[model samples]
Target chain A: MADDIAGRGDPIKTLQLMWGRIEAPKRGPKSKLAVADLVRAAVRLADEEGIDAVSTRRVAEAVGISPMSFYTHIPDKAVLLDLMLDAVARPADGSEEAQAFRPEDWRANVAFVAREYRAFYLRHPWVLQVATHRPVLGPNTMRAYDYFLAAFDGLNLSEVEMDLSVTMVANYVHGAVRDVARARMVKELTGMSDDEWWHAIAPFLETVDFSPYPVASRIGPVVGELYGLGDPDRAFEFGLECLLDGLAVMVERKGGRR
Target chain B: MADDIAGRGDPIKTLQLMWGRIEAPKRGPKSKLAVADLVRAAVRLADEEGIDAVSTRRVAEAVGISPMSFYTHIPDKAVLLDLMLDAVARPADGSEEAQAFRPEDWRANVAFVAREYRAFYLRHPWVLQVATHRPVLGPNTMRAYDYFLAAFDGLNLSEVEMDLSVTMVANYVHGAVRDVARARMVKELTGMSDDEWWHAIAPFLETVDFSPYPVASRIGPVVGELYGLGDPDRAFEFGLECLLDGLAVMVERKGGRR
Candidate 1:
């Protein structure tokens, strides 16, 4: 356990050895494998086959290395998943938008961040599941959170209130994405298109007496029709707008505190 | 199937016969195996062994019937799941509160419904996963939805706004309960007492620099502390208050648009 430094055969210093491998300079004039390279490969695998398919052996093979070789950089599969999440969550520069932030432009800023975050999740649905659980304190996640906090800085909210607001938004985004992703997975696995399945289940909807739930029942059809627009981005945006609208009212009532 | 129904069965009706057997009544003089019975059994199985342990066969056996017998009332495992969901989602009696509704009473009413709904989910965590996937049109589900929608009926929100508001509240309840359930499962499977695990993870949390994500980082400890409170009632109340506080502003702004 004492001789493997970046695959040189050290055991006792496993974590340190892995960190060294991750930080090692590129060996070739062009490129050799790096932690980032491995993370990218893992993300690609997850995108194609779902997160359940990802493993040290699978990622190593994708990177043209032996499974044991992966130990040089990542301590375990959990660490690899963390790194992959971080790689995908790299802070959105949205510099153009960030620079545009102004006291009067708070709503726009909120909308922009929400849209960008939704886009990020849309591009990597697996991230939603992973990030919601076992949230790794990674650089990318921090960056994303930083942008959100900064957006609300001018609202003069109490620490607790601010925390609650951020939690609400984050959970909303996470939950919405999870819903959209599951819907997509169901579509892929069942081979029954969303509308086709809805039609099959329509009889159930039609026979149910919703007088007891007039609001939901009345709007059920419209919501059902919007089910899998085959695009999460739009659904997310719609939900976000409504959430922000609700938040906007809160902001005003709190005397513009933030 | 005809023999069971008419004393002579047709070959083409074998499949139907099998389904009828699956749906046959359970034991006891009062027992008339219905979809409700299977759903109740399925819920019990889920609560005892987790959702993965629930299947048509398991449910049938639990009710003292052949595996094939479950098909009669439920048609398929998916429908069994749907039935279980509806059974668990039976409406909360908000009539007492609804009769006393006032502008200021809205928050408490919403909180009550949310708490009841959360309690329902926590009692049967498996329902959280299913509830998040699709729209609910079952009688029980509708009754629950109507209770929520009725809370805000006189508050002056537009039809669309009212729908969106309900969705947001439902999303929050579902997400929070799901998180708690997952945490509970982890604690059970890992065999680590919550305190022991938290102490072990504390050092890592302290060593991690979360300055970049001031809000999430600062609030991480609070979130972690609240992690396994497992009382869906408490979490639901907390989130519901925040949401209602947010919605109160919306109500004020709309100037009683109803």
Candidate 2:
């Protein structure tokens, strides 16, 4: 899961697969499945099951190939993971997400980029589980980074601030997606909505004294009644606005924009 | 590891346990271990290993008891997990973290609360792996939430906004912690500092063309040089300031705080 650090594999071999510079297969009766086919199957398996299910052997089985032959196609799970990460980095061509590079209206462009990541992550939720902090050095990953930075091209900030700005947006989005995803997973796993689950525990909770925690006691129920732990969109939008406002304030301080 | 949802176990029994109201054990020769002892063992195991290693049998083995006998101490892994969560929730008494009930400077209080969560999560990083969206209906968890809400007692937000304000801070902290923690884990697992690892891979990355990603091509290396994946504190602080700034703007808009 989170332990699966990207760029941990043999850099040359993994980079070869990521950049589509893979050498020819060993001479034998070759399998029909290409590297892309394995990655596709792995992604499907991850989306259906979870990141832990994306084992090399399991992926090979899904593609109707023997594990032995699959080894020839890809070296190991690490390389396959890098491939999966970089592959998903690209939005479908001509999609609104693919065009997230408007130099004008930098805030709107930044917001759009943030939303695109949220959408893509929710679609391939497993990607959120992988730690891409090691930096997935691939074409599409690079393209996505470049594209995201393009949104800030119109802004007057140092290159480092621009990079840090992207990190902030990415961090906020990651947290927001996790909040929503956790709620969905708990509901699915327990077959109980947060409300129903709370209802079941209310009687027991009533036996305990809540006087010691006046604020949590008062605010806890309000948060529950409001968001039901399942919906954090309101909270997310609130935070996003605050973050952007803060960024704009900084720009103004620099005598750049007001 | 992220799949372990809190409050998924039997709620009444779990809630009973969380409130320290466990029923008497079934008729048997009692083993000399309280539930606290078992939870401590489980927490230690998780810290040394990972969350997945905290199975009932494994914890039982760690605490020097048969798996069958351990069942008497706790019903199952689910209950054990809930207990471990709440047990870790409490900071050591009289520590700066344990005393996070500042109502004076709201922003500093919020920042302090954020820092405490980050510190504790780093110490017990496995907690980050467990999805606590269902909300561990335990005293310590409740106390933590309530205490956190106290930091915003001076904020002029609506009830729902108050709840969301806390959520925003929590989400930002969560994201920040994950960033720092991911860096720490990658360094430990690869046994290579990010700089060392990047130096090894730099030769191969050079072979890949970067003409398509002009912005990334410019900023990516600067980011690497500034703060390798192993270091994200500067970026985190930058984002936190922006978040607070953004929040201040909203309060001003509400005609509450200047």
Highest TM-score against the true fold, candidate? 2
TM-score for chain A in each prediction: 0.72, 0.88
Q: Please tell me which predicted candidate would have the highest lDDT against the true structure.
A: 2
- Share of native interface contacts present in candidate 2: 0.66
List the DockQ of the predictions in order. 0.17, 0.59
Q: Give each model's whole-structure lDDT.
A: 0.60, 0.75
Residues A61-101, candidate 2, lDDT per residue (tens digit)?
99998777778788767677778889888866677754545
Q: Tens digits of per-residue lDDT for model 1 on B1-258?
A: 000001112211222222233344477464467656777788888777766578678889999889997775555555555556666675444534345445556766667666766677777765544422344345566667777776667777765566667766766776667666665665564555546645655654565566656766665556556653234445445455656656766777887632
Question: What are the per-residue Cα lDDT tens digits for candidate 1 across A136-223?
Answer: 4456666777677677766866555565666667666666666666667556555656567556655544544556666666655565
Task: Per model, state how many residue pairs clash.
Answer: 20, 1
Q: Measured by TM-score, how close is model 2 to the native structure?
A: 0.92
Sorted into a CAPRI-style docking class, model 2 comes out as medium
lDDT of 1 at A17: 28
